[model samples]
Target: MRRLLPVAFIVFGVISGVQCGFGLNVTVSSFTKSITSSIGNGINLVVKANASIKIAADDDNSGTIRALIAVSNNVTTPLNRLLGSILAAATAENVNSDELFVNIFSLVAETRPALDAASNAASDLQKTTKEYLYQTLSGNLTELSTILTNLTDGLDYLHLQVYQAANEEYPVTSKNITIFINSTVIADITMPLEAIQNYLTHVASVITVIASERTQVIKYLTQMNETISNGLRNIQNSASGFNRTVIDAYHRIMAQQVNTFKNINQTYAAIVSRASSYNGGDISNLTMFLSDLVAANASFLQFVSLSTNYTMEQINPVLQDRIAAATKTLTRVARFIANQSAINISQHANQCAQRFMQKLQQNPVVITRLSRCIQQDSNALQPTVTFVQYQMDLVRSAASSIANQMSKVCQRNTGACARAYFAALPDHSQVIQNKISVIAGVVSNDEHVVTGRIINCLYGTGADIIENALLMTKKFNRCMLVGP
Candidate 1:
């Protein structure tokens, strides 16, 4: 049961990442396992990332309103947590994917005890986990950094090799391999980074809240030279494992993405090998071209070279771009979840705090005793005060991180969306350009041979050939202006 959740989570994450492919390749479904991993991983990330959103059930739900209004209602009784209402609203509303994230957050809130086992476990390790995660997430992910670097290097090497081979194999270099290839892979990675960043920001906020609560409890007890009440400690202790579970969820999701990256790395290596080593080992898409090249047919090398160029320069970039775009959408949806979560938790916490304050107000004797203890042992109280201050600082830091990350996501996603196209222009656009250029050259070269004075004596057959070439050029020119 423990492992099953992570597997499911990875499936969601990978599936979300994979859908951002260029639509031209009908063969993209070949990566069928990716969908499984995407959903499996992403589900956990969404749940863990969604913790704060469900701080309390929305009272607007009839079930919850009825529950709250009941005289015998107890803390143990389940509240609506807005799960059904949020989902129904999501479906009926014209909101984008962002609202879907809020629905997930609401559901997580509804299932708090189930989702926040880390907190319920009452382990101090949750704090440790939060510290480490904050450090790791705030910095670079080494594996991802390495993968992107290698991908860039591999693409560069491919470009160098392609340039050297372009003249000999195809007798012309038409496409700008560097501009189209390298640029798009960057887009592929951008969306995942954005998505993960959103999840992590909320995660940091949850931890800060946990830490702050514990510190407040400690401060309250230190004034009396005593420990906090069992009830108070238990409330704080319930949060001990929450941050760790959130971190674990992120890792589970990212692990699947790392696998996806590895697959792309392998594909990149295989394609580059075709140029770098110039071997005919097992290029899946170019069986016919490989066969022709192996048979020592130089003329077929043009077809082989063009096929390789099409695969490398056009298709792969679009595939990566699509994945990136899909991830961006997934991450953008995370915002609504975070916003709803913040509202619920703040309101719920305030109510709980007010109840605590009213109970203390009714206990003048206990308040007087606590005040005397603090006045008599001001020095003894200094340490707890400092700790509370430190925790408040952590909350501030986390809030800052959330703001910064959200700002960056907005800037990058909005900018990328503004320039959106489902497929790369250079994918088939360059092909159109190449075909037109080839036809124009052919027509220009054969102008004298076809439409010269000799064509008038030859029953105008050469003239007809020239006219057809002009028509073909016009059609191809139109194609170049738009796309294939």
Candidate 2:
């Protein structure tokens, strides 16, 4: 039971951090310092208890308990020093969230050895015959459990502190909000589309070169190459056109909507500022303010509706078409491989198989170009995946902060009205994430099929030929047919 405490606290902290969108705050320094102290004290108690158990187990000639304590000591020294470093690093309130989680995670991982040793020691004492050994081990474990429970209490306090810290009201200004919507929201969304368009153009060029190679021995090789080449071009063109016609247009529409939203927010702020300066006897002024609030809310709702409808009607169908183009390409390549007659073209087929094997071994110009092209494609996409994920972290933080500010205004309204207004706001993070994932998935699936069916099949034919040339064609067909 005591051994499970660390894991539970670690999980609690992680879930709390995630729910807050992992934002940095100006009051987390004290909370980090407090938790670090608790973990340090817990580590010391564990080390002491472990040393006492080792001495007693050695006296009783219990090899199992002695070995456990030795293992525990090996990790204890490093854990102690790392905790000191964490204490030193928490000099400011706005400590990096990633660094704090990493340090906390390190403490949990290193402390696992002591927890496991205690658990095994308790179990071994259950079967011991000597009364002295049982008494010694049992007493120390009780003390250790007490210490762990104290640490658990500290962890609970720290978790609550973190939650409250993350929710502290921030002063939202027009400048900062405009910076967020324009840079973090709009730039993050469109940059990937641009990168992907460039990627498609380059891939099309490489595929065209590979498809133009004339086969000397294999008659069907030319046809299969043409099928793959044409399919890739279709995919490239589909995505390229979609980006120009749909995604670019959507980006412009979103930019216009954000500008409108910014204008409306400024109008609301002006109204509030003016109302605050008025005297209490101005009933007509108060009524005018209420009318302005209603108008602002209506305009905000209209903006949300326009953005949502534009995304659904303009963007979604083009995304589907891009995915469909990729799927169709993969199917055509697979069908071409499946339709080959292995029996009818025996003489030329054998020569063709031998040539394929030779090409893989000698690393000819075609094979070299193909390998480099595949590598280039992977390199292009790897960064997009990482960039999108990093941008999403910022997007989530912005969304949470914006929602917090909006909720304050909503509280002035009736419950049903507040719910309706809050529910209509766009989830920019989720929508963008879903769109990028779909595009990446299409490319990833196409890459898998090409590598497995075409590149790997050729390489396998080489290996099979070395073992038995007669079985090469059969194995090659089998490899191509199992395309993923």
Candidate 3:
């Protein structure tokens, strides 16, 4: 029992030591946990307060400390809000500078309204004072002269300033606040006082001059109105008479000329249709046949000789008369042609063909009658040779003149007038050749007229036509001489 008691004591002592050590450890751990919790709570409270304040500090030490504390405590929202507010304040400062400029301009403009009103009041006062002085003084010459001189000087100075302001270069300086304020003070107070003193001394004279000028202006305006009214009435009557004369003359002369041209155009068109058909047969073949006929027969020679004389004597005269009539007809015809429906060759082929045929038929009858008359005069043809020679010479001369005129009108180049003239030349030569052919056939008993008379006429006419056509072509070269 004694030995067990000793062993139990030793075990109790060891157990006590272990229990004491565990208690000490528990006490230390509890103390540490309590201190850590208190420190963490203090840190959280400091972070929360700092976050609510949104502190902004300029120095690096304070800013860095605040940023570090904020990051460590996870207070980012407060730091960001503090940064945004600081930026907003900076932006506002910049905006205020801009607003200052606009405010300054508005204040300056507002000053002008009051200044203008005061100026107007001052002017009225000067006028009223002058009237009173004039009434009181009546005719004080010396006083009036002095006052007038002063008033004139003041007005001249003001007028000079106004003129300078108007003509000065851009970016006006006098209109600015500092300059305007200074100028207005000088003009209104300093200079005007001197003018006022002068005005007080010689008010009557100034008032009289002003009243006299005002009367003159009124009289001048009245005279001007009367003169203008009288002049306008005279102009109205003259214009009415002139208009009537012009209208009547245009209707009577120019309109009649136009109508006549229209008729001549219709006739020319008929002639062209007739001529087209006449020449429809193979001209080359006919020319060859006539050449053969002239070479084969002596009777044909006699006939050609007789026909030549007759053509010169009788046929040419009749033809000339007919040409003279036709010329007049052609003038009207050309005018009518100008007014006719514009030719659209593609769409109205039938109408064009009909018109062409009708024109051709009308002139052939005249040609045929004249031809027959010449044929009948074979025996009497010799006596009329001189007249025929004279007629041929005249035709040649007329053709030359026509060619020159056409050249002048047509331009030498590729103008429409030049084209028309050239195109017509060949056709005209053909007609002349045909006439000579008829004469030759009648006189020479040749079936074909190409041998003598027709060939001669063709050679003569063709040469003239070519010369004229070339001359007319030169006119087109001078077309550029005409100015816009």
Candidate 4:
């Protein structure tokens, strides 16, 4: 009876444990299915939400909008809580399983409209900012161009004035008033133009208002007007000064030229008078006398050769030497006469040579002639001395006239050179300065244009900024509606 009771009790306990395990297994399986379904639904919702948001952001799409709404409804607290409870019950022994449920629920909950709003806002801000930048840049660029143009014009005027001032053939005094007026105009215009350019370059970085920029542009225009006024004043002042200087210099130069001409004429008269006395009466008579002298010498030489009783040996050496000497003397006389004629024809050339040599003590043309005469008479006799002396005196007078004329020419050229130097000095200096200023202005204007173009390219043109903004907004809306 005791053994039967123990077996019965053991059998009862085993039956009870097996039945309980079966029932627990059924509950676990049901819970596992619920958790699995919830997890799958959560994952699907999350994917749809992200895809919808991404598509919306990427490209406007109606499907993305619908998907986003569906995702929001699917990730409700009731669904999330149900899945959380099942996951907790199924994975009582697994900490990771519980965490996974929490993570999925929180991720879906947090990632809804918050992320979408941020992305949409960022895109809208980008476009708005770019449009604003483009408008500002465009206005600034226009103003900068105007300023640069004014500056360039002013610089051109300055360049012209400098050119006129430096040029030699153009009488500086005669054109002095014009040059002064031009310079003053340039300076006046440049002052305002420079001010405008500087202001534009400096303020361009900081200015925001188109109206303010326009005002600045107006200011520059006013400055240009003022500059013109100032230029006129400067022109008047410079013209007066230039006119006085030019008139004074011109009178002085003319007086000196006249005096030089008078002296040259008197010197030439003296030469003609002296030559007349030497030749017998006048220039024509002198030429005839020279011809007679040549004939007489020829006749005398023939007579000496035929009438002399000297031996051929004695006459040969002396006569030949005399003939050679005579030939040299006559050749020198002919050369002297030719040079004197050349000098008489060109008084300016003679004056130039003489003036240059007066300070140097060396006359190249005179030296060359003298050298030739001496070289030609190298093997001459004493009987040729008179002719040589006469030719030397004639050459000396001709050389003197040449020297005098050369001196006058040198004086004239020196004065001209000095004037040219004085005129060119101011011009060269002004031209360089103007070029540098203009280049700087141009570079600054170029920078403005580049900045404006970049802004326009990145955003849109000033004319189309609003249109582009609306178009971008519409595109963003369509992208948000589509799923990725």
Model number with the top TM-score: 2
- How does each model score on lDDT? 0.30, 0.37, 0.32, 0.33
Q: How accurate is candidate 3 locally (lDDT)?
A: 0.32
Error of 3 at 483 (Å): 65
Writing each residue's lDDT as its tens digit, candidate 2 over 1-484 gives 1111221111111111211112333322123433333333424444444434312333323243443344334334444444444344333344564566456556645654554564455455343223333444444444433443433343334434444444447642333333222233323322332332232233223222211211111334434455446544644554344334333433443354345435434534543465433222222433443344345435434543454344335433443443344334333432233223222223343444444344323322121222232332333333433443454344334433433554566554335544443344444334433443443344344334433443443344333323342343355555445421
Q: Rank the candidates by lDDT, best first.
A: 2, 4, 3, 1
Separate clash counts for every candidate: 33, 0, 25, 23
Per residue, candidate 4 scores C-alpha lDDT tens digits across 169-208 of 7444432434333335535443543343343333233222
Q: Which one wins by TM-score: 2 or 3?
A: 2
TM-score of each: 0.19, 0.22, 0.18, 0.16
Give stretches of model 4 more than 4 Å off. 1-423, 458-484
Task: Give the lowest summed-lDDT range of ten residues in model 1.
Answer: 70-79
- Top model number, lDDT: 2
Which lDDT tens digits does candidate 1 get at residues 1-484? 0111112111123322212111111122212223233112322332443232222223122122122112011111111222223223212322333344445445434443432332223232223223443333223223222333433343344334333433344332223323332334433433333433344344344444543343333333232222123322332232223223323433332343234323433433443365422222323323332232223223222433343233224422432343333223322322222222222323343334333323322332121222221123223223422443343334223323322343444444224421231122223233333432342233233322322222232223323323433343344334334433
Clashes of 3: 25
Better of 3 and 4 by lDDT: 4
**lDDT at 240 for candidate 4?**
41
